[model samples]
Target: MSTDRFKDLPIHSYQSIRGDIQTGDLLLCSGSYPVSKIIKKVSKSRFSHVSLIFQWVDRLMILESVESYGVRIVPLSHYFSDYRNSGKPYKGNLYLARHSAVKDLVPNKLNAMLRRGADLTGQPYDIEEIVKILASVVIDDLTSIRNDKYICSEFVQECYKKAGLSFQDDGRGFIYPEHISKDPSVKPLYELIP
Candidate 1:
């Protein structure tokens, strides 16, 4: 694919960016995949994946549940580098957003959410849940599946719920990344362009 496909899009450098991204910021991505395409089409949104950010020691890390890796912590630099090395800008494009209501949360509450995510590291990705989510989209059902496994968005929703931030219900465990992006309480922070 050609970088020209994304030439007109705004680009921002991670190194040149100002200000600290506090813990609990949402990292949204327009992933390139058949599944991602379906998600974008069904949700009528550009985002396909969502991750939670947390400051781990001196570095910022993303907590996300992916089909291949399940729940894992990836350094922000590594995440950005993946896009830079890929050459295709749109494949790597990512947006950072924060829960508009999280500003009211005390430091303790924010830390609690981060801790909850950290504690879940290594859990297997819920492949079955992904199927259920896709099926729900096709059937126009918004019901969330009850399961011990987690998808990226479901994990994020659970973290917020643990921290006492309630997003509009989209079934018990069926929240999509688009759901998080569309929530009135989320505000875009920055875009990482190639």
Candidate 2:
């Protein structure tokens, strides 16, 4: 069997991207799809500070959450940015079966911790747990991501979205609610590695 032949096939389907599924094909899912015109407008606007921050936070959170689930977090920056700049939705979504077979280079410890926390908690795990876990790393990454603005912002935005908060950074730190130690309503992040 030649690998070339498989490259020509339509390897993805839409239904798989829209619901719970398990299969051998691994893929990445991003923020609320079918991005509304409002979201699109806000995402590209110059002064939509709230939306911009939210999107960045949501993206980073998704990246970490998914990575924790053991999936290889391919920044896929080139792919995503190319698609966004081209005004097209990303089409590589799929459902992967986390059997004891396939493997990738990304670590799975964070994913396991997330799963354990969820198990101890419940379907809608306490947002505080997620925030506490994420905030612990946010500052660390902020200090190291000086060369990658997109990624730094993405991380911050995802955490904000998952934690249901808003923020404004002064380059050195952030400004938001003082007593935000409480959790916010968020969906359970799924696992990707077996």
Candidate 3:
């Protein structure tokens, strides 16, 4: 893996990378909050929610492009903090997935379901954690958005809403928006995320 272009890509902590190590394993890196937040922003915009999901699907296509290589990529559940605390570089059985797989996979009918699984079930999901969850999710829709460039963000939002526990916003600095507020509509800052 030439990591030259991705040198800037955040290196997950040693613990985060270690637990998922497997020789020849493909690594899936992603975030939960940023994804949903972006979706929300797109939803609030004039563009249809479908257009937002389409954009996200396009991004997923870029992130998950490695699957095209025929390598099975997997998601990691540990936090980058765990990896960082471990104080070691990932070695032994981990590989980064192709960029396309990261961004494009979500658009496929088969993979879209997998992405939904990640968003909904990625408990304790953070940036690296979400990636790992997504990696583990099985792709069932490969052609849903093949011809179309837009996906309905409504579906994606529903997935995030279902996450219930486990999922957290992975935006640069933003935590859960609803969590910070007291309003019922506002998410609580901290909840029992399984």
Best by TM-score: 1
lDDT of 3 by residue, 54-90 (tens): 1232121111211112111122322222322364332
Per-residue lDDT of candidate 1, residues 96-191 (tens digit): 778877778888888888888888889889888777666776677556656667888888987898789856546544677877877877877677
TM-score, every prediction: 0.83, 0.21, 0.19
Query: lDDT of each prediction vs. the true structure?
Result: 0.74, 0.27, 0.26
lDDT at 104, model 2: 32
lDDT of 2 by residue, 1-194 (tens): 11121123333333333244321122223234432222223323111111111012223212222212222223323233443456454443211222122123122432332243233221221234324324534444432222212222233233333323333433334321111111122111222221
List ranges where model 3 is wrong by over 4 Å. Answer: 1-25, 28-84, 97-114, 120-194
Clashing pairs in 1: 100-185
Residue 129 of model 3 has an lDDT of: 25
Pairs that collide in candidate 2 are 23-97, 56-157, 57-156, 57-157, 57-158, 58-157, 58-158, 61-158, 68-111
